[model samples]
Target: MAASLLQSSSLSLLLVVLVAAASTARAQLQYGFYNTTCPGVEDLVRTELLAKFAADVTLPAGLLRLHFHDCFGAGCDATLLLKSHNGTAQRDADPNSTVRGYEAIEAVKATVEAACPLVVSCADIMAMAARDAVNFTQGPAYQVETGRRDGNVSRKEDALRFLPPADGNVTVLTHYFAVQNLTMKDMVVLSAAHTLGVAHCPSFSARLYNYTGAGDQDPSLDADYAKNLTAVCGGPSNVASVQPLDAVSPTTFDLGYYQSVATHRALLGSDAALLNDSLTAAYVQFMTNASSVDTFFADFAVSMINMGRIGVRTGTDGEIRATCQVYVD
Candidate 1:
C-alpha cells in the first residue's frame, strides 16, 4: 500500500510540472507584441498612438487590405497621406477614395504627442495601430515587436504604383506578392481579408461590365444594397466600376470572403482567381468550408507576422527620421 501511494504521488507531481511547462510554451507562442530587440524593431513608439490610430479606420477589412497592399510593396511608410489638403488627411474629404489607414496613423500621433511626446517613430506607431485596429474589431490580437526606425521619405505616386489594382487577375497579384517572398497560399489566405470592407465603384467596374456586358448583378448581392452602390458609383463605365471587396460579410472580420469565392461569386477578378489558380486552389478549398473563423484568423496572424518582417532596413541600413515625410537630420 505504501509503495503504491508513493508511485501515485510521483505521477501527480510529474503531471503538475508538465502542465506548467505547457502553459508557459503557449504563452510564448502567443506573444504578439512588438519587440524592439528583433533585428529591426523599435520601441521608441508608444502603444497609445497605436490605439488612437485604431479608432480612425471606419471601413472594414477591404480597406485594411488596400492599406497593406500599398505598404507592403513600397515599405509601410505612409506615403498615401502626402496628398492631404489644408494639412488634414485627403481621404477625410473624399467619399470616392480611401487613403487606406493614414487617418489612423494621424490619430496615433496625436495621442502619442499628448503623452509620450516624440518618443515613438511614426513608422512603428503605424504598424501597431494597424494591429490594434484588427483587435478592436474582434479580430486576433497580435504581439508587436518594436525597434523600427522611421523613414525620411514618402511619395504618393510610389504608394499608388506599388499597390495592386483592385481588379488585377491572379497572375499579376501572385507575382506582385511573390516579390515579397510570400507564396500563393499566403496570397489567398491574406486575400481572405475581403471579408470585412466596402469597395469603391471605380475599383470593380472591369469585372462587373466586361466583354459579356450583360452586367448581371451577383445573385448573392442584396438588390437594395446593389441599388445604393450603383447610385454612389454612377452606373459602371468601361473605365470605372466598384464592388465590395467581400460580398459575403463586408462588416465582420471572418472567413466569409473565402466562402464566397467557392460559389463563383467573387466580387473582384483578383479574388475569383483564388479558386481557379493552380497554386492556391487547395488553400481556397480549405478556407471555403472552414467550420470556424479561427482557421482563417490563425493563418492571418502568421501571415501578418511574416509580412511585418519584410523589407525591414535594420542595423545601420536605415535612419531614424524626425518626421515621417522629411529626411532625418
Candidate 2:
C-alpha cells in the first residue's frame, strides 16, 4: 500500500511539471510582437494574398465592414472567422455583414485548407486581408502577429456601430477611435489608406452636387470628371461628391494624402479633419513637409501594429469556432 501511494504521488508531480511548462509556453505566445517566423505566421501571409485576389471581385460590403468593426475596436479579434449558421437556426434580422469580400475569404480559406486544414481562423484571415489591402497598394507591409482564434459569429449592428461613415467628421472620428484606445496620430496614419482604389460616382455624389464650398473646388479634377460626378449625384442640391481618396496618387499607397490635406484639397471630411483638429495638426504638417519617406514609413508600421492588436481575444476569452460565422462546439 505504501509503494502504491509513492507511485501515485510521483505521477502527480510529473503531471504538475508538465502543466507548468505548457502554461509558460502559452503565456509566451499571448503578447508582444511576433514576426513571420512565429507559428502560423505564413498562414497570415498566404491569407493576405488570397484576400487581395478576392477584393478584385464583387464582395459584399458587410464582410469587409465586419473586419473593420472588430479591428476598429480590438485590433483583429477574428470575429468574422466564425462559420455561418449552416442555415440551421432562425436567421436574425441582421445577419453578418456581407459587404466584406466573401470571395476573398473563401479563396484564402481554400489555400489554408490545403495546408493546415481547419487550423486557420477566419478572424485572423480578415485581419490579414485588411493588411493586404494596404500593402498591395504600396503601403508598408508591417509585421502582424498570428495565432488569433476564430470568432464564432458576426453581428450586424456591431459592424454598423464600428465602421466609420464615409463622410464622418473629425470630432466623430476622434471620439470613435478614442473608444478603441487609438489616438489622432493613429487615425492620421490609418486614414492614409485612401491611397488605394476608386470611389464610385454614387458613393460621393453629395460633395460634387452640394459643394458646401468649405474648401476650393478640386482644380486637379478634370472638368469632365467633375461634370460627370455632378450628373450622377442629381444636380447641385445633392450633397454627395465622388473624388479619388488620394487626389495626387489614388492608386499608390503613400503619404500624399497628407500633402493634399495640407493644401486644403482633402477629398473627405474625415481626411480634412486631420488638419482641422488642433491635436493632430502638427503631425499633418510634419507628414506634409517632412523630407523623409522613412519617417512616414516608420509611423505607418507602428500604426499597423496598433490596428492589428485591436479587439484581440486571448487566453480563455474567445473561442476558435469550427466555422467563421456559426456558434458550434
Tell me, by lDDT, which candidate is best: 2
lDDT string for model 2 (1-329, tens) is 99999999999999999999876555332332233223564555555564554555322223334455567533465554433354321122122322445556656666665656656666666766666655566566765555566444455445556666656777888777777778867887777766554455444554554445663444543566456555655654443444565667766667777777776656665676677677777877888765756788778777766766666665554654444444542
lDDT (Cα, 0-100) at 252 in candidate 2: 62
Against the true structure, what is each candidate's TM-score? 0.68, 0.69
| RMSD (Å) of each candidate, 1 decimal | 12.8, 8.3
Model 2 segments beyond 4 Å from truth?
1-44, 47-67, 73-75, 80-98, 201-203, 211-243, 322-329
lDDT of 1 by residue, 1-329 (tens): 99999999999999999988875553231232333323223232335534443554454352355347435645654433344434332222232255555554565455555554454556555656556556656677777544444444444445444556665667888877787777766787778767766666656554444424676654444456455555657766523444556667665667777777776656666777676667677777777665756877888877776665555443344454434443212
TM-score of 2: 0.69
| Candidate 1 wrong stretches, greater than 4 Å | 1-63, 66-70, 82-97, 212-234, 237-243, 290-292, 316-329
Ten contiguous residues minimizing lDDT sum, candidate 1? 35-44
